[model samples]
Target: MKGLLYLSLIILIATILPLVGCNGSSEEVFKGYQLPPEREEGTTVELVIHETYTDEEHQVFQTIVDMFNEDNPDITVKVERIPKGAQWSRLTQALATKETPDIARVEMEYIATLADRGTILPMELFWAEDHKETLVEGAILSNTYNKRVWGIPDQIYTSALFYNVRLLEESGSDIPDSNWSWEDLMQLARKVSDRNPDVIGLSYGSSLWELSPYMGSYGATIYNSENKRIEIDSPEVVKALNLLYGYQLDVEGWTGSPIQSFINKDAAMVILDSNSIPKIEDSGIRFGVTKLPHGPAGSVSNIDGTSMVIFKDTEHPREAYEFLKFLTSSKIQALWADELGQLPVNKDSFKNVDVNKHPYLEIFMEQVSNVIPKPALPNYSQMEELFNMEMQKVFKGEKRLEHVLMDITSELNGETQKD
Candidate 1:
């Protein structure tokens, strides 16, 4: 009986050893795609990354990872794709369960939240002193909170005013340009709407993010981060909101769904970001892109992007940091620019781009100089939700603009205290 049991145990070990060797020596497969060989003989350090990228983008990313893996034979990187819409929820749950990946691609807005939770490693600890200078303006600032950068920005882009060329010409309106002011935009939009009542003059939203540029132009900011207080109920904010409200009220602007309205030709002009360009082009809209009309604060728009962050509890910190650096390298940025039309975060990559090949980027490049970084506050999203809710009430005529602003100011200030 003892001899028979020993032989069975020997057979089990023989089967398991081969499976372990196969797993360590063979190529890694994920999501039905095979990756480069992950050798068996080294102290294999595996770094997992959670990211949201389209299938084509993932292929490009996989190729990039293969290059990195070839250069560093001891390290193997694995990407876990998360649906774009569910990224935040999935990441939060992972953090709570302590099952988070070594690295993650996070939106700029979530940097503060993750950093404040002490779940993300600060970039300042691993990065060189002058490294921040290599990125484009506001790139590092977007991920900065509490005087430290929590992530390395991988993408940066801002919005511009998109006008229907045919509508502008048919209405006999002067072509809009970079130097155009808010008043100039309003006048043009009104003229176009009057010329054709079927079309609204503008397509926009009342959300704090959308209203931020106009608010800044009017010399009002949503929050005073330095003072740790809300500043959204000021006279300047009211003035800005009232001007936008006037446009909507007077012209019956299509604020319900601005992008859709622009697609349907119901809106003569729309404020949109780079992501909207492909859709607009596909819809066959004869459009032109220009800077958002200058506000009192100049022609500033909201600047934000996706950034790479290392989880604080990651076992492979050095490898993760190295991978973060690789992702932000000029070569990688240029590849993203060429393949995905992503606005490069690296200043060197931006300088080397062929603007003639990507003409829309030329307009974005012009606007990049004039952008306001979103406030890096832990409760920013919560504040944004409350502000948007109040603003919607004003838009629906359920409350006056001044009353709503005052209420939001109080409510958001209370939220800040809780934070």
Candidate 2:
């Protein structure tokens, strides 16, 4: 009986020893080797993002990713840089493949198209009421279409009046106040140019995007999205076009890249967006930025921005939303706006930013609150090109203002009806 008991005890000991070692000995082995600390135990998720950003923006964006990864050890965010003009094409192709990125940075204008194609998930799926309240209403509205929110706005911007201080002083004109009208702007322009014929009073582009604020101030609209028609030939639009063309024809100035002209000191006053601030600062030009001059509709500007959208087919929708939320958080939004010279989409971000240091941001924020966004139509680009061509006819003296306006209105109306 003792011999049998000893054999049984030996067998039991042998069986239990390997099990104990399997449970704890490996940990001990790693501890003895001073292995790096174990990673947080979770299913690691890899999220691929497709984005198009300038070199400077790319650097800042990478830092944002790194910060996020530090906080979320289980999630690895990978960004693929798409060329500036190739985002849409690459995105469409990716959608056809199994390797579609989890997130894509799309322009405000492309949001509607992506939503229409059902390529992106509706924001309602992930956004809560509390989250909705944190964003700027105008920014949220720009991302909404068909009564559904489609994208999370990341960056917003609008144009503001930029004036050269020395030029204004030499022209004997007082700095324009917020309540100044088109007439006031005209007077300022005239005074500045009259003082020096070599320097143009104002410099601005004639593209539809550039002209949006001008048209809005005069109570003109290129497309009536609610009514689904073109209103470019309205009396207000014609008046606005005539007045602007007259400025260029009667006033002394050039009509190309506004920022370039301003940097070259070829113009005393220029209509430019916030992005132009750094270039102007680099040029060492003493400048002041203010709201655009008022018109029949009061001070007006057009809002636009880049947004992030999640693919409908993304395997990790929850993780992707976390990132979008992260991007739009007050802290991140404020940091992005401060570094990129962009307007923040999160209203709460203002608390962290010092507008005194970035005075132009204040003007931009004010403009964004009450500005008209570009119509969120899939074919907006097509209409923009057509309007550009027709408007050029008036500015180039190739066609009468009234005639060009009539033709553009008819053409755009036809396109609207086709939709």
Candidate 3:
């Protein structure tokens, strides 16, 4: 859904691109439309900080804002907190008016889309001015293309297998280990599903993002990083699809709306990220997390996070850069990770908290090391949609796996030329 929002904005902007400016000079419209000009320099610069965070979650970030303002009296930072679900529409609406916040907490996947639009300012602009060490591990490379960095990773998370301990025990299934194999997971699922007809073995979202852990585990790669080409028609990917297909048709696996079903005891296990701990903790469901079972390739999980980026059009580049640097500083990043139970990107932040001390976190911390990231490409949003459609066809038995994969690879590779 979020990927569609990015595609929609890009399409909308391209359709109504400006032909010229008010000064009678022909305006140069790049792929993203146009690069915004900087605002006039002033002693006191006012900046707007936009990001999607709940009122409760806002406190964590707001505390940082307070610290920034106190440290730098000359710069004023305003906070704009939007609900995560509404971010796409809100951001699209603002971009329609050619307006964006001075700085925003954007998802790593969105960097390439925004950067291509020329709305995002390069991170290099602040490299010389600020000495902040950016946190990049577990961060998607969509923000870094052609040797230019777009944003600083603020928080990182990887997908893990979360099992309901009580549900597994009730179904007479033993809890799986951290090094369990795919065969082991399947066997456990069969045992649990046989006991509970209404309950499924596992629940996960049916999309490229959710399917990534399984795909990577089986060595199914969507992109060839070396050649920058889409290559989805490999034997490994086909096998992975057949496995998921079996789970859906033969095993009657559950997909999507996982959190509620997991809490309701309708599913024995669910694949989710660390951010889910707060939800499961309050549901009174005794749960334990472990790394995804190893497939032919190896155990793998998908990594995602929010990145802090500045707008190229900001009037106060220097002041905004100062705040950007402050927001991404090791001191602030470490504190943020500890307060939120999120994975830190900065190397220094790692030592501040013993991730193993927290429940379920130690499992996630280990899984984070063996993870895969979403691809960073200008046409990524569209490519994601293509996978969703093609994968569904295979799952529903409407298309042969081999044929679908071939079409996807050709279609995606062809899309690159169009761009």
Each prediction's TM-score versus the true structure: 0.84, 0.83, 0.79
Order the candidate numbers by TM-score, best to worst: 1, 2, 3
* Cα shift from native, residue 183, model 2 (Å): 1.1
Name the lDDT value of residue 185 in candidate 3: 89
Tell me the tens digit of each residue's lDDT in model 2 across 173-211. 799878899888887888788888888888877678888
- Return whichever of 1 and 2 wins on TM-score: 1
Model 1 worst lDDT window (10 residues): 20-29
The candidate, 1 or 3, that scores higher on lDDT is 1
* lDDT for each candidate structure: 0.75, 0.75, 0.71
- Which order, best to worst by lDDT? 1, 2, 3
Candidate 1, position 245, lDDT: 87
Using TM-score as the measure, the top candidate is 1
